[model samples]
Target: MSSTLHAEQPGTSSRGTPDRWESQRSFDELGRPLRDITFTVVDLETTGGSAEGGSMITEIGAVKVRGGEVLGEFQTLVDPRQPIPPFIAVLTGISNAMVADAPPVESALPAFLEFAAGTVLVAHNAPFDIGFLKYFCEQQGRPWPTFEVLDTARLARRVITKDDAPNCKLSSLARAFGSTTTPNHRALSDARATVDVLHGLMERLGGLGVHTLEELQTFSGRVSTAQRRKRHLAEGLPHAPGVYLFRDHERRVLYVGTSKDLRTRVRTYFTASETRSRMGEMVGIADSVTGIECATPLEAEVRELRLIAEHKPRYNRRSRFPEKTTFIKLTREPWPRLSLVKRVLDDDADYLGPFSSRKVAEKCLAALHDTFPLRQCSDRFGKTPSRTPCVLAELGRCLAPCDGTVDHDTYAAVVRQLRDSLLHRPDRVVEQINARMEALAADERFEEAGVHRDRLAAFIRAASRTQRLSALTRCPEVVAARRGDDGRWAVHVVRHGRLAAAGVIPPGTDAHTYVASLRASAETVAGGPGPVPVATAEETEKILRWLESPGIRLVDVEGEWVCPVDGATRHLALHDAVARSRTELVPFDDRRDLTPVHQPAR
Candidate 1:
């Protein structure tokens, strides 16, 4: 996989980074009550361009609303105690004569603060108004109130297209929306017009499934104009856990994703936080958004994996081709040797891992050679041919299997030892390396020890994950359950390491009927193939994680899962205790506390 900054590596494109990753980011609850939120929409007329440019507030107007009802209003003329520029007077019509007898800004600030306390602040261009008010409040020896601010300009960019209004200016939007209250540049009239625009935008957003304050505030600035127009694609999607498909005009699937709230997740594509240019391009061509409502989040996730594999959509970057994943296999040559291969077959050879990335595989391979006496040669032998011992043999790192110095029987014994260390007893390798690291550090060979230390960490991460995946894949059948966002239980059935059946079991549903129906439906899918190959390694890892989630109950299972006990993974806790205090980091006594903890039962 190429490591391009903009393009994701293959088998990883389907997943998002921490910021936008579906599983990483928290979701809004099933039904977020948007109407109950109170908002204080404020506007200000200033004497000049900006607060930083010696401008002061000339007028203040705000309207507080909740559930579409006007809670209260605050309006006043503020004396800047300075001359109002002619350009400002012409633009806002708030001239020196109008504010000559008005109360000073000190007097108007308090009343507006009282009206806006404990509510969201919104404005056409929020920074200017908020900047003016916040500066004066501080100048008056009062603590500036912290208020969540929303910009109507940003929201307008998301909701109203340039075609609808050439620009999102207040006058343009007012004329376009046909607001009865026209903005004549006065503060109160403009604020009233903004209120109308706010209501109009909210009405449009409601149809697009955007109903929360957070959603409205960030929708416009981040999403492109083309994406905003396609909000109608999500008009009919249900607000539940499910999968969504973004399709082109030719009915080609461009992207696929799963979310607990399909409507909200799909709407997020056209919001401000979604700043990926590639996603913007995808949205430009997407003609429709389609969704499939699943009974549970687990079911939705499983469906996403299958769909990504089947479609191989252009926009999707991850899990596109599991077939390309590499495995570190011990080749069944005249002399058994470790080698990286793309596919795992029925060849009589032992396999250590089907690693996710090649970088890690190479690190583990290099570390393994350091600990075990294995031949590093590329010669394929039909019969034992006469050859000289290489440099690795001279350094005592190899047994010289290519030469007559190490006989076949003796080399075979060494290969068996290496196999034992890799498969069942990985601690033999970790403990050996740890001892060497400790020795080097004692002799002030710090740089060399650090290399071994990093190699230890790499081996542990790779081995732990490999062991967990192998444990799940070895089982014939397993059933688990986790509570859904709603008051229901989501049951997942796995057979031969693939998701066979998954459906919701409501609190009061009949247990026997649910199981029967689930099994009948699962039979159609589970019977497709016997067992997944190394190509489906990602599925095995995903299943392992799902099985480890909290509150998961084991409804049924088959076979005992054999776990590796004496590995760097299980020994990591011991290493961690001493790993702190790098200045005096001494390897503590080897301790193994990696006990198996079962998921919670219902």
Candidate 2:
């Protein structure tokens, strides 16, 4: 992590001015040669996953290198202020005691920033490390210094082939190249390993004619020759936040994407940075790229969803199939049963979804059936006893409405409860399902309990999302504003959950006048059939995400925008915890060491 370059590179003199070699050596106009650029390779170990969620950096390690020689190193452990999660502590071997006496981020950040000043920053996964640094600076009210960033993993992806290494992970690349140090999860060790991987990748860059830093930045090892030939397609695109559409020879859209910088993002399609094989193929077939600039990132996002849904692009996988979403319907019959339907009709049937998939909708319906005595059979009853009771009735799983065991009025009451649980109130449903799960677990029915747990999670999440979206769409007019980092305000006019209009208000502009004008010019959107909005659920859901994000303020509202008190919001944490357990492959019953361990100050 520490070495000195005795010979101060061929281009510069001892006094730090350019020498004769600087003028004679050929270089690209975009930037300096890679050999002359100084890069500060950095790595950080944090208390947990996200900075915004109060996850703090536990250790910082960086190595400054230029011309393949390490210039200096900086490493320090920081007291996170909050206790570290036991899993994180075990991962990095940095227990609470290890950082008890160390400086906190308030003291440690400035030192690292100063140590790595005036140099390009490099990290294996640059976003995670850089995000923590940027967030810390914001919290401290310190101006983050502008520094060029290069991800070694991205660099490796551009240079190293699958034959050379399996993946771009630091350890993998370190082993691929005969590195002197091995990454051991500790910050300094990983940073040192990354420096070796960087050098090895730089060496391979020469064969690809990536001598200049600019060329190296855009180089991708797997980018085909055909992709490079279509680089001109990105020309004339504005470098602003918006949506971009890649069109085929017939002017049909092949793909749609949103980006903060339209030109840079579209340009990546022809470069190694665009790694998705499907995207590369799309770019190969693309005859042109069109950019639609928007006032804010929120608008860009909504526009992207709309464009993708409209075009149903072959290359885009997500929003293209939004119509395939299903809904859990309370059947409009004498003895109503839960049914899955594709569309929302005006038949007065209680609906709880627009679920992302049929499997999730089925899970939600299963939860309802497990809790209530709703008929499991699909047979329609004509008020009187028409058919024999099924086994579900004998097992006490159903009310046997078909055989007159349960009257229409009683069955209707149960249907009302189910609808209320799915829509306005979910507390009873949550309690009932949770109690069932506990009872099964008490009986040592772990597998059955696990199934119940998943169904409960799916039910709650779907209920929460549906209620949140429904509340927004129910509002006739809603106006909101979010202040950007640049001191401008992004104002949005939502009419029945559709983005009617979007604009930005400058710092000095009068907010009142600007908002009024935006509202006046906004689109006149009528309420759609039933509880839905004029916009699609996916589009409205995107608007809801922006409305709920931090810094968003409701400027005005024409109608009520509220979720029920006993709604799914209360159970959202349980849903999140269940999802996290499933993702981490942890047993649902194992709650130990998941919470932060507050070791007494050493």
Q: lDDT of all the models against the reference?
A: 0.72, 0.81
lDDT tens digits by residue: candidate 2, 458-571: 889888888888898889999999989887899999999899999999668899999999999999998764445477787888898889899999999999999898799776
**TM-scores of all predicted structures:** 0.56, 0.64
- Alpha-carbon error at 137 in model 2, in Å? 19
Model 2 pairs in collision: 158-221, 220-272
lDDT (tens digit, per residue) of candidate 1 on 270-357: 7655655567778899999899999777778878878889998898878777666666677777787888877667776766666667
The best candidate in terms of lDDT: 2
lDDT value, residue 192 of candidate 2 = 93
Worst 10 residues of 2 by lDDT: 586-595
For all candidates, the clash counts are 5, 2
lDDT of 1 at 403: 77
Candidate 1 Cα errors over 4 Å, as ranges: 1-221, 382-386, 436-451, 523-535, 571-602
